[model samples]
Target: MANPWHALEGVQVSDLGEKYFLFKFFKEVDIHRVIIGSPWTFKNHLLILHRIHENEDPLSIPLVLADWWVQIHYLPPGFIKESMALLFGNFIGKFLDYAMKNLSNGYKNFMHIQVQIDVRKPLKKKKKIMLSESNLRKI
Candidate 1:
């Protein structure tokens, strides 16, 4: 059986060095078939994917996926105030995993997902906060 995951080739990251990543999916035979996201697409897409899972909670759907990968870029301006890299990274990864499980067998939808973080300018001093498991208690 051929894998249905897509491969990304000739992919380019944004000039600003914004966090960018490539998600690849292959069929059982390992053939690349889709590439639908860029570093720029993460911000807009991340939240939507999150909600889908929240709304459908308690019921875990199994997505038949061949392979999935994410390339992350640094954060954008203003958004860099607080470092949520680790936090967001896991969030994004979880969402991608969920997405993989949700993709129906034989159904095609361009769902290459990415999460972008804002990186500060060079030679600049920024406040980096340490996020811990205890913080989740406050939420």
Candidate 2:
């Protein structure tokens, strides 16, 4: 685990008993890096990480959220901006980051953004967005 994380100051991983473990990082940047680079797997099983907050129950806190990069395809020409991608991402889940470099790919067919989502929840395959009552686009 520490090998893949590549923490600058190294990390201390402790077994918190049964399915749970604690990760101690020397820098906040390391923690941020790990959290952003989510949906990790070891031998095909998902590894969930949650930052233990002050006064929070380690065992009781739910660990269902994971950061995912979603590619929005077939977007209309007018909806390719960062703001629009953010709106669509927020509609799907909590928006994290947008692929700024991919803002205008060949033909402007897709937009990619990272969002934090609950793995336990079923994701929507398609959604209809109404910019106004007169304009509706299915994404």
Candidate 3:
């Protein structure tokens, strides 16, 4: 995990037993960079991260939520508006933000949305929505 993170200085991972770990980073920037690159996994299991304060117990910190960037592809004609991203994002998970800046001007196949989801829950590959005009909205 540390190797893929590419921390500028270095990182130390402490095993806390029962699948929990305390990740210690030498550089503050490296830690922040790792956090910004959310939704990391190891051996197909989700690696949930929490920044605990000094003197806090690592095991006690909440670890139920994880942020993920979901790609919504081939949006229906009526569902392609920027404002609709919030609605679609919330439908998948807790809407965090719409990544409109990530999309190129020429790109039209999909949209990016950041959402916070429960790590315990299974992710859905496809979603269905209903539009007043179209009756069925699948993206």
TM-score, per-candidate, Cα-based: 0.18, 0.76, 0.80
Number of clashes in every candidate structure? Answer: 23, 0, 0
Q: What tens-digit string does per-residue lDDT give for candidate 3 at 1-139?
A: 9999998878988999978998899899998999999778899888899998989998887799999888888776556656678887778789888764335556566778888988677877777765564454433
Please give, for residues 31-136, the per-residue lDDT of candidate 1 as tens digits: 2122232212333542111112335532243221212344333333222212343344445433232221123575323223333323221222233545556754
* Candidate 3 lDDT: 0.80
**Candidate structures ordered by TM-score, highest first:** 3, 2, 1
Indicate the worst ten consecutive residues by lDDT in candidate 2. 130-139
Off by over 4 Å in 3: 101-107, 132-139
lDDT of each: 0.30, 0.81, 0.80
Ranking by lDDT: 2, 3, 1
